[model samples]
Target: MKNYDVVIVGACTAGTYFAHLLAKEGLKVLVIDKDSEQNLCKRLDIFHFTRDSYDQFDIPVSGDGDAEWVHDFDLCLSKSALDNHPKKSHTKVAVMHLPLFIKRLRERAISAGVEFHFEESFVDVVYNDQKQVCGITTTKGYYDARLVVDASGIPSVVRRKIEDDYIESFEITPRDKFYVLLKYVQLNNPDDKVELSTSWPYYKGWIAPQHNKSGAIIGVGANISYDYAYKCMDKFEKAIKLPEYTLQYEEKGCTPYCRPPLSFVTDGFMVIGDAACLTKPWNGEGIPSAWVQCTPAAKVVAKALSDGKIATKEDLWDINVLYQRGEGAEYAGTRAMLIGAVNMSAKDNDYLFANDIVFCDDDKGPNPNVVGTLLKGVFSGKFSLGGLISLMSASNKGEKLKKHYQKYPESPAGYHKWAKTALKLWKKVGTMADTVKDA
Candidate 1:
């Protein structure tokens, strides 16, 4: 049997990036994917990445002439339900083709000595006498490895097959995912061409510049399915005035929109990226957020496997501590707060926007008297009492969750007790899907 230092399933962005990072540390890495290399990451044709993220992760920037590069924009605006009040933020963003971007990432991994096997699907995991994952069996053959990582996106192929107390194998159901539909369109008038991104958060829709100078991509995301996403798009078009455009094509995909597993590591195994539900709460973007976990994990995993030492849960526990107490904590609070923030009526949403409450330009930090303002809105009949209560309750729960995450156990010794409290808090926070009526 062939032996490797690490075996990673799913050779998409997460798997390939992690593989490259590990291989650079002198670890033997093997990455396998069910799809052919040519077909990788083709589900979405266009996506956006912030310019700063490239430098943060030390990835090569896609320039104007690059095959992956589509265009660049600096301004992003979010409008109220009535489309009256617009809140703007500035950040340089690069538009790129997904498959081409993945290709570039894959090339980097190859250059770093990471082995890749295309069209090889994971069948199951091989366990040692201690019930630790020692290797994985694929459709073609078996390969032994000291560490096994699951980066298998939403299906979580390898993670779902493992039966362990540390790893949660619950399927990401329709309710736990965001079904996104994108419509590629060409504007009828050159003057109406889009150069920046504009979002209507009330409808969960946005329009952003595409590769074509006179074209743009209109997208909407909702719980349940694409059919529901289409309904959201309809509601958005009716409420907001958009430039006239003809649809050229459409694409659809899903992203996890729920809290991630409390523990991402176990005996000789770890999970990252979409397999671990590491997506941003506000945007449902997984790449940069998953990289947040991957960065620290690579360091911890490299050290755990050094000098031929077996990586146990205790050895790998630092990955959880570093992540859970940092971005993980921030995301947990934001995710919880958003559920209540968006569960208000359209009139209430417009009131908040008009009053510079929630969707205001936050470059100067939040308003100091947010509580007083919310109370004023409630009394003025602009917002419902129930909505106000829900928002306050959710915000409180979010704070508690964030503080709890900050106290994340340094080792696995106190994890169960910490997780027990976290579960109860999350149960009360509920999910964004809960706010969707009839979904």
Candidate 2:
């Protein structure tokens, strides 16, 4: 039986990057994935690593100017470019070919002496008499490790086996899942802006160009089922210009939207990436977020190992604390603000776009005082009173949650009490259909 200092159960970007970081510290790391080496991360859609993130992750860039700035829009062709645009610093992101990008990270990890275990399905956690995770059992066999990192995505085979009390949410409802489809299509003009049509509050279609101007990944995201997503994507294709030169590829996947756990660390274990639900709730963008979320985790883990201390729950708790105070909190607040907006009818949404009330054409996404703008419109008889009330209520609810997240505890002793407060506030958030009356 071989034992490693750390075992990572996913080969995606976050998992591979963490392995590289850990191995660089001279830790004996093992990375396992159910996917075969040749078929790993077979995603055809484009992924992004936003600006200021490249240096943070230390990822090598193509330098072909392939890493270009991208923009989002409500309706580009209609000339109503209302949007939730990235800040100026984040405006230009590294538009990546995810398969190649992941390959580079994997090879880097391998060079740093991280071992690979491919085509092995994780069965369950191997626990010691102390009721702590001691190792992981996989299809091939059982291997002991001082720490196990579960990045196996939302299904989270290893995480699911853990006792319920350890996690924030046991499962994500179907309504909380986002179904996505991306098809690579040729573009007549390569200089086109990345288009996002938020015609549906919870569902949006996007057009992202390949940096080489050769083609683009056109995609649609919805909380609906896979069948409905495919149907929506099909209808969405007709709106875009069809392939003029070549249609390169197409892909589809689904991800759940659980609130990020209050804590990702437990006795001898930590979870990252989709398994930990590190995705941004707004756009369902997990790639860059996963990178950011796991980077803090790696630092905390390294600190424990460097001090010659075991990676116990207490030692690893900072991973959760730091993230909860940062991006995790941001995502929580954003989700809170979106519930009411998502339920609005298409016509009412169009009114916001037409008036430049919500998606500001200016550099900022929405106006800083968006609710104020809505009220002024109400006075002018441009917007309805009911709409004004909904936005105000949603905004207030979101603020309450953000403050609660900012109050996340510093230690386990205060965690459940804080989490109980969080869960209570969370329940105050109603479903889109339930919260918003039909217009």
Candidate 3:
């Protein structure tokens, strides 16, 4: 019957960040995870944190000239780079060795008096008579807290505990793509420095290096159904021609993108990171949105607690409203855009290459990097029209007609709204497929 101010389930990247932030504010925090401590610490994949973020968190970039966390895409994009790029281009990003990075955050939280519990799984969620989440029942014991933060990832325990209506508060759901990644492969040129290379295919993941002279080769893709992805995965290994020098330390699973609940707080409880589905809906990039969105979530939670207002699902709805106003809205919009592109044509891989509209190369030369190409396209506003048409066509004819009906608005709002509505409608179409049994 021990009680804490806050109990955080799942100590992964976003969970680590949330705990550290909450603990720093003098909240009594306990972080629990099902994974072994060593396994959690050994996660070495490149998790990105946006630039300007280090200043927010008070963590300095690594001073080691070689340990640079922030890299200027402009400096290294290609021999040929574009003159103008999308606003997303100038945004500097920090890519970290997630395990070590998380360890540092955890250490800081611990120093600030946060408790850590490992190898414990949260088996059930506790609810009071009001149907508000009170705490969690874990393998170790039933721990009560004034607030519970479920960062347990997509298959969320706290979310499951709530009624289905409560679960669907944000009106979002999962898509059919999952990412199977190969981690920690040493290349033949172990001595060589790691550079960004999108040429390695399968929707182009990433090449992340470790201090131990080893690196990881990652790949990602969308538009492929989940069942087909297993076969596609076999082909991915073959496509990459995974080097013999590449030692497979770990293979990991991730949702290709998560359509997170718009708001994650409910009566006396809140969720963060994957538990809330704070993942990107298109590229599976959860780290940026997680960090960007956490500050607001924390603010609301802290405010509710200090104001002596019992957090309620209605309050959670308000919090979701707050989130949707910021990066959350942009993420939703971006997802709609990408899904529209995907539905345009299965063969359309416009994001993978530079098009004629935005063909400007870097002053130096054509840097075969994908960012270079992507930036060029973004600046030119040369999105895949074919993709747009294809996506709309795939939706029910009724949905398409609804969009057309809205097309007469003076501005572009109608288009965006129509696209969002159509995306939801299309998702409903796929749900029927989910009911079909596997042979």
Local distance difference test scores for all models:
0.90, 0.70, 0.55
Q: What is the lDDT of residue 234 in candidate 3?
A: 55
> What value does the lDDT take at residue 403 in candidate 3?
44
**Over 4 Å off in model 3, which ranges?**
41-46, 57-60, 63-95, 169-177, 183-194, 199-218, 222-250, 307-309, 314-318, 343-388, 391-439
Q: Write the per-residue lDDT of candidate 1 for residues 161-245, one digit (tens) a residue.
A: 8798888888999999999998999999888979999998888889999989899999989998888888889988998889999
How do the residues 1-439 of candidate 2 rate in per-residue lDDT, one tens digit apiece? Answer: 6888899898986689889989987888999999998888875436655655677777765545343233322222222113322222124455666777788788888999999998998888888877778888899998888889988887777777787465653665556677787777676665543443222232366665554455667677766477777776675555444345456676788776657777788877888888887887656778778878777777788877675434778888888788888787777877777775655544455556655554444454556667677777778876677766766777788888888888778888898898888888888875432442321
Q: Judged by lDDT relative to the true structure, which candidate is superior, 2 or 3?
A: 2
Which of the numbered candidates is closest to the native, going by highest lDDT?
Answer: 1
Q: C-alpha displacement of 121 in model 2, angstroms? A: 1.4
Worst 10 residues of 3 by lDDT: 78-87
Give the per-residue lDDT digits (tens) of candidate 3, residues 59-163.
Answer: 546433533343322221211112223112334555556676677677777787888899999888888887777778999998877778877776676666666
Candidate 1: stretches off by over 4 Å: none
Model 1 deviation from native, Cα RMSD in Å: 1.0
Maximum-TM-score candidate: 1
Worst 10 residues of 1 by lDDT: 358-367
